[model samples]
Target: MHEDEWGEPGGGAPSEEHRDRHELSPHQGSGEQEIEASLRPRKLDDFVGQPRVREQLQLVLHGALGRGEQPDHVLFAGPPGLGKTSLAMILASELSASIRVTSGPALERPGDLAAMLSNLAPGDVLFIDEIHRMARPAEEMLYLAMEDYRVDVVVGKGPGATSIPLDIAPFTLVGATTRSGSLTGPLRDRFGFTAHMEFYDSSELSEVIRRSARILGVDLREDGAEEISRRCRGTPRIANRLLRRVRDYAEVRSDGAVTREVARAALEVYDVDELGLDRLDRAVLGALARFFNGGPVGISTLAVAVGEEQTTIEEVCEPYLVRVGMLARTPRGRVATAAAWRHLGLVPPEHAVGAGTGVVVDTEPSLFEE
Candidate 1:
């Protein structure tokens, strides 16, 4: 998160628009939105995956309801599409309250937050998506709201300023972030509960794909669902998207039924490999292996060779690769593991990383570069 003056965190919620406001990102298409919305679990009971999160959230909500008070502020941290947003919506739905949805970038000034906070109904849920990126001033405002349900709005300019204390309706704040580590110490400390969403394994992802298919009226065979699940990179959003794409392929190229082979072909056309390597993912690996001879090269150099941002390479591309054993991030730099070469359809050199060949490069590369 960039260090900037933050705005206050208050907003009005006349409707449930806040719950649906976070942008899904570049790969999220308009046509699938209806189906995606339809497929979202409305209640915690229906949510799939993240069993630990479900249990913790259930306890928090039930405890609050029993005490006849608003639930504590909740923080959900994980990569996109692991159901952080869905869980927020589910909490609101279960509580039978409306939710206001906004991202950190949307709340630019303290006044922006004050307007929203001043109008919330008691027991409402205000979800701040990508909250780690919120402006510094707004984040400061949120501290009081989360802890005390109060905000101090400064009226007038310069030396004539006056701090006006505003009492907001008791409401629940649900904050979601991909990088919880980036959150300020005070902000992170204010959360009553935090859930770390992990990637769904193949079985869970298969269940997710099958569930979406059932709702969308697609006839997906058991193995077909598994095939799609395996290539989804452990993300439900990608699994659903691939299922829709495979459904199209099935209808146009086959008998309108999703079989394992059909799923394979559809994903191949989409350029998603069995290892779930996309264009950018493969590019990072290719550059690391081919150009750098299996690496010890700096991340910046690898990003340069691939024409990508260093952060994108480190944050987005490298994590999955390292998780799946296809890449390794050494103190020296990024090294292509033996599995990476094999996945890219090349044999590992005798000098390959972890190959016990012991052929070191002329110069060891540092992560920060020269």
Candidate 2:
């Protein structure tokens, strides 16, 4: 087999030790690419959730089109699988402009970016995913292009170098980044519009599931869809994926229909619990609960215990855990809550601060009485 980006084997299961199931599908750009493309909501009208983003983007695009001017550079900042790429595609569609898809990592050098920028036709949309990862030189080149729609090409060596100013067609740059904080001030300042995508709620994710099921010809019951949505960790992509697996279970094990029981069973088989805790997620909580004893353990220590990258743990696992109140981050370190202990089938310590007196998860708190 050929070498991968990490200089490892390319044709098999990934060698990256801590790649969770959530990170596998869409993040890696492998198995779910085609399926995701099919399920993508083309127009803003067809899109679900992110009401504020949808409304603001509509106004921006309409205003630009009304004035017969190209739309300004737009930036989308959020976690993975939050429909940033889909929104970019939708932007191009609304403008009736062709889109050129590239990522920051793909644009390694000044010339690489210059080539793409110089060739763009006026009003075309250039989508750069993971814009924060772009090289310094490339980012510098982008500043001029975004402002002046021109690129300075330097030919020859040293003092003999001749700089040729090339006028590029005015194009819209649509950038998407998970780490907006990592972006330089100059780059962040370049985007005229920034859409901060939020996580989809259970209702929105349920709708996404039902719509996807209809498109994919999967017979999913309402309860089944709800089950998947609740356990999808507020992501449409995850909901769609769980539905596909549940559909397979339905076809192979029982009748060709996904019911609540079927959905539960299918998710259980894959280690996705009631609270949408996938394998890696559970591992993090389990470690915090059982191994570290509801720890104020460091993130790096936890990552080592779980065989994952510290960044992966911070970016992917910590957000959801914190959101659900399973884990708490203190100045000292990360600590598991009583809820986390109960989820992993462990009892919270009686002496644990903030855990309450004999506090039982899933049971309502009582003021008094035996």
Candidate 3:
């Protein structure tokens, strides 16, 4: 898997024409690039939310630094934009170690991994993002290097082959993946600890927004931050992005002060509704209701129906809907529950029921029923 395979084209390549219509900007980095260049947390205490994970990571780094030993291999799993990469950098900073960053898809050949591993200083942190997408041969080479601090490079053809075992520095390997379940069992088991990042609550998001607003030197009223937080889709990255957009809107349209009204107006103008559903989100629901008859539709079909990628629907959009109690994943496929229909101002059919199959559809008024 190449970096392009992950759905983001590299270089200055122009976005495809079809994608241009949606106004979806290309992802520049793992969301860490912006943070690193601008707002990265310098210390663990500065990182907001996920207190338990932060504490555990702090202990790991402290113990390793105290003993002058390499920290154990660690895994961080979560949805995108949740600070996995940031945590990896923080680990390196805490250990007072040099850090090298790469992604699974970027290490295409075994030689690439070997080159990177061999150059690492003792106690350094080599952070691999999207670890599940690493090539098999490269992944195999990593196992030995991580376990024994050495790698065997085989040169030449079978008859004249020479195997050379080269020693590597005692560096810590930190792997981050959005889909940990897709990782091989051996790879998954090698990690000493795994941290699963969860969606931030509104309170946590508000804290993140407030912290970011301060860093960006934006004048944010308490109500303004709260309003922005409510529409952030429970992700720190989204919160930061929304903050930047709202700041721009405020700068041009208002007195350069971020207030509740300004935030609300900006978000509305950007097509993010009061409930935080964007145009694409409403399109997905509308397609389900109008075309699939409030389906139990397959993800692929739904994706095609809404003109978005399946992964986008599953990983990004569906999670929020599921979190808000509007969508349900059934054995058959995905179904719009009563809340979803009601959210769209549609009435559930007489036969429609909740995921439990016990609630009667008639109990809820449908816009279509009358």
Note the residue pairs that clash in candidate 3. 347-366
Candidate 2 Cα RMSD (Å): 7.5
Q: Distance from true position, residue 321, model 2, in Å?
A: 0.9
How does candidate 3 fare on TM-score? Answer: 0.86
- The model with the greater TM-score, 1 or 3, is 1
lDDT of 3 by residue, 272-359 (tens): 7777788877888888777887767778999999888887687657877877877777656677777777788898754454634565
lDDT of 1 at 15: 15
Residue 361 C-alpha lDDT in model 3:
34
Q: Which regions of candidate 3 deviate over 4 angstroms?
A: 1-36, 355-370
RMSD of each: 6.4, 7.5, 6.2
Clashing pairs in 2: none
- Cα lDDT for residue 126, model 2? 96
lDDT score of residue 118 within candidate 3: 88
lDDT of 1 by residue, 251-328 (tens): 999998999999999889978899778877898888888898897888878889999777777766777788898887
Lowest lDDT block of 10, candidate 1: 1-10
TM-score against truth, every candidate: 0.89, 0.88, 0.86
Error of model 1, residue 263, in angstroms = 0.5
lDDT of each: 0.81, 0.81, 0.77
Residue-level lDDT of model 2, residues 12-111, one tens digit each, is 2222223533445455655445566778888999988999999999999999999999888999998666788889989999999999988888888999
Q: Cα RMSD (Å) between model 1 and the true structure?
A: 6.4
